[model samples]
Target: MRHQIASVDADHTSYLYEWKLNGRWNKLGATVNSDFVPMKPGSAEEFILEHYWAITGEAMLTRWNTRWSMCHGV
Candidate 1:
């Protein structure tokens, strides 16, 4: 994997329609593959993908936690 330091250029949300990955807007029913697969039992995907939360405005003090389902399949 290539690593570089730059400002975040994407947006993430609970709904797939509002998500932007890799600097491209994700439309409904669109899919993108990545090398970052969740490992057995506990892995990085769990902590990163399991929960949805947002914080914004005024020094980013306010945060909203959104509930969603976690899917595990191959």
Candidate 2:
């Protein structure tokens, strides 16, 4: 499995991806400006997404654990 981080700049959006390789998260590839305004998926090229830490502490922890396990093939 892999992990991805999404961020927005002005009117543009970007996604950065990483893979857990050798116990370390390493940079992979990214997609940018692949959507239209008001937020509709556009065809620019690339893949992405997931929300950030806006949930409860426990929920955040659970999310991380789940992702960690998936990355490790656990």
Candidate 3:
């Protein structure tokens, strides 16, 4: 299984959307907008990790968390 950063918004507010799947198109939940702050640094990694636990299905958390923690030390 793998994860992808689908989209991000940083104009006025910092918001991110991530799509997680195993060689297929599967949608995971999105992260809550972290309020609007101009000139703030954006982090795709932070966005994905923040919302990874809320992904759809039962085992998504286990699969994603295990992989993420292993590689990124989450």
Residue-by-residue lDDT tens digits, candidate 2, 1-74:
55556655554444445666677776544444434433223322111122433443333322110112122312
Kindly list the per-residue Cα lDDT of model 1 for residues 5-63, writing each as its tens digit. Answer: 33222432333333446765444322232223323334433334434433223413222
Better of 2 and 3 by lDDT: 2
Q: lDDT winner between 1 and 2, please give it.
A: 2
Candidate 3 whole-model C-alpha lDDT, 0 to 1: 0.35
- Backbone N/Cα/C clashes per model: 0, 0, 0
TM-score of each: 0.22, 0.31, 0.22
lDDT score at residue 19, model 1, on the 0-100 scale: 45
* Predictions in order: lDDT: 0.33, 0.38, 0.35
Candidate 2 vs 3: which has more TM-score: 2
- Model 3 TM-score on a 0 to 1 scale: 0.22
The alpha-carbon lDDT assigned to residue 44 of candidate 1 equals 38
lDDT of 2: 0.38
